[model samples]
Target: MRMCSADLNLLEKWTWNSRQNATYAGDLTSDGYMSTQQLAQAWKQKFPGLLTDNRHDYLFKFVNDQRSSTTFRAFTEGLFRAQEDTYDIAKETDEKLLRPYKFCSSWVKNVEENNDTLTQLRTFESKQEYKEMITNISLRLGFNYDIQKELVKHMYQMCRYNKAWDVSQISPWCAVFTKEDLKRLEYAEDLETYYKYGYGTPMNQQIGCTGVKDMMDFFKIHVDKDTPQQPRSSVRLATAPALLLALGALGARRDSAPLTADNYHSAVALARRWTSSTIAPFNANLAAVLYKCTPNSNLQINEQYQVLFMENEKPMNLEECRVGLCNYTFVKNRFGLIADNCNLDFCNSATKTTGLIGFTLLFVFITKLL
Candidate 1:
């Protein structure tokens, strides 16, 4: 029953952590060798959010809708109990206990062999990731019926972009004119379009406006000459979501062609009026923006997003296409500071130009009018 200190330590470690599945059944929910009962008691006292919130994720993470609604409702009712607690539980061991659940090869192999619906799902970059995700979901409850059709519609719309954009989905000259994406779009729509874009937004001040100086003011790095290892001043970090919003707007694209690698640089060069990185910045912003979800993954991942989609001019306009590809509405909501009737997307009014000498400078201008 007794052992050396090192042996005791390893035993305690394994007892506390399964070093695998993050589920409650694993050990390592605590410091070491803490029993499941002790871990559960600790969780009850410390992390209440971990209890109720994980109910959805635990069942949904790799689960599809297999159980009936009645079953789900009952599952939730019993599964979502929070015991009265005086403190939060720091189940540090729980993190290590659940790592094994991350990869279930058997689950994937089964989907590949037994699931025929997996074939109907679309692929991106010839990889099996998206289809694998769908198969995993189908394995859960409630996905037994017409889920295939739903996924088909979703894949064709969000994951394929080798052809010209549907004009109704974008603005004039906004589509990048990709041959592969539009061909796929055509097959899906029976050579028909959902909408149309006859007249495009006025070309004046669409993207390049005067706020370039203010936007750049925020990018400067402060340093200490004495130590190259660390900066004396704080590096105020900003999010890239705002940049996505401006690019997502109906303004930046032209009716002439899809925003491809050929034209994105031109668009960025035009946008240099308000930012620092030039064409490089434009490409970086597109990469950041594309990572977010869009309604139209069917378009293409590598398809240049610099062009906003429009209606009638293509299958989906660039402006509309932007919304389809990413969820940037929250960032756009922050652009309210732009003057009403301002010709451009936004002015970055939260800007302040601070000089090393001291006084902070503020500036505002009509994007198009000036």
Candidate 2:
């Protein structure tokens, strides 16, 4: 189990206090009370590698465990000299050191792969350049796990988007994408100026970056038609164990009793829900509502299937309800907020008019009823 930084800081405090105080101060007892000295030494012995390299991270394993408080009774024994002095340590470690360290460590481990894509990517000066290179590479090789590093890089940048998205402060970003990214993007439009950074075709073209659909078209024309071998399995070697663990966590009990067919289906659905990038859990219910609301709706069987898995529906914000792939006609016909045609200008105008009219009609209807 990986340790969190919060737990690590607590362990560090205990270790510091234990070193100052007597090693074996507490009286021995049959109730299994561990002294401060005993606890630190036990942890050191248990995580020999962590103690040598990163002791705080090492101690996090014990502190994070649910049984740690019960098992390591010394932690609860209140042996620390003072709580006030140690407070600053917690605040500084997380923001100043641990987060950056974790980011850099993840980068080094992920980028050192024996591939040319990564090697060439490191030469790029800007994120836009890197993205263009990735788009070009995908055009040639078809999408595969080979582009995982680039995906990670995009994820890192996206995380920082709309905030202090400065990658220059970090070593990995400085080395890979240049060291002058501190100046935040001027606006949302600036951030999404590239078509590659946004979704779908029209926006991708308008934004002047390659869209995923372009990659799909290229793969269809160049790679998929030429491939003679069986379709490469989407499932990777690392997938099964994680899936099993997820299943176990989600309350599958194969050890106690055999899983039913329903149980298997439910588990698979859960996995799909978790893995889906476009279709959110709420979108499933939204689709169901759309299907029920629209009279003789034109939704495909697969589209309907997208919503049927959900048993209950939650309220979604207007933006949240707006999903990709599904046509606007269903929503427009039912709510009259979306335009009949899919043009952005018409859609935007109709959305505002629909909201005003819908609310005003409701007010008038209620007044008349009263």
Candidate 3:
């Protein structure tokens, strides 16, 4: 019943408009506004059992909900307005909480800006399956010539966006591609995501430990039962890249081999385990819950356990504990090193250069010094 979201304003506007425009049959008065009792009855009819029979309860809930929305809007607007008054790009970039990856020079250089990271992505686009998809879609749409990859990608995105916005209506852009073709396009995107931001690179996992460490520290305090000044639960809104890094830190949904063009057809079976559609989809969430278990006849004292859920399903199992519920001690020991230190030196150190060029540079530097 408690709602906090970035779309609060939109939701409020939609709710207000819907309520104002809705026909309430006999509930409306001559003045075109319903009494408290009439409004309650109308809400009860519309939502069925969600609203109580008492008009006072309805009014109280409405007022509190509106207050929450207003407070949230004011807080967010105030923060942004303050930022606008004294905007400094450098200062903003230096904020670790806001831009954690920007602090890691090596990650910024080797991963974020590296052209080599897109090797698999470029290869996938050049593959026969991808080219054929473009050709087939063009022919299906009555176009004389084959459409470019960018055009197809744009159409695919439009189809996805339109479908998400209104599920009741089918998008015209989606008509260009068949179900099979959509799957291929989805797979192509999966390759890009996996390589660019996922467990394909070790640096991602290393950087991800920073977030995991904070989560572990918070959970540890709860397990120990020491009263804290902070809120019981924590929520962080992060970008897709940050989400991917956190997934890497947790070591979840990783395949034995890297996703590449060679395994495009073969990796279809592995899609269930490693596909981006499931791993990093829109509004994706990863959560860990701590549960206190009562002492049974086998034990004398109460115990605390933890369960990690990805999108509401417990998908990971730790070797030290049971399938779904992991022992606190085991969870602590397993990720202790990662949680303690993310080995930030790895981010500071330059990646090793290779081949004749590297040796030539070293030789030239030594020769010049002598």
Best of the candidates, TM-score: 3
As a TM-score, model 1 comes out at 0.18
lDDT per residue (tens digit) for residues 1-370 in model 1? 1234553353344322243344432211122222222433342343243233332222111111221122222223333444333122211112111111112233223221324312222222123433443343344323553245355444444322111122223221112113443333332231111011101112212221112222222112211121111111111111122222233232333334322212223544233222222211211222111122223456543332122221111223233344433232322332222322333222222132111011111111000000
Q: Residue 156 of candidate 3: its Cα lDDT?
A: 86
1 or 3, greater by lDDT: 3
Using lDDT as the measure, the top candidate is 3
Question: Lowest summed lDDT over 10 consecutive residues: which window, candidate 1?
Answer: 361-370
TM-score of each: 0.18, 0.16, 0.64
Model 2 scores a TM of 0.16
C-alpha positional error of residue 241 in candidate 3 after TM-score superposition, expressed in Å? 1.3
Model 2's C-alpha root-mean-square deviation from the true structure amounts to: 27.1
Off by over 4 Å in 2: 1-112, 126-370
Clashes of each: 95, 2, 0
Report the candidate with higher TM-score, 1 versus 2.
Answer: 1
Task: Tell me the whole-model lDDT of each prediction, alpha carbons only.
Answer: 0.25, 0.24, 0.52
Q: Which tens-of-lDDT digit does each residue in 1-370 have in candidate 2?
A: 2224553343234322232233222222222233332433443343343223221221111222222223333322322322222221111112111112112332223222224323222323245644454454343333543365445455334333312222233322222222222211111111221111122112211111111121122223322344312221100111111222222221211222221212223443233222212221110111111121222245443322111111112222232133322222432332222112212222222212211000000000000000
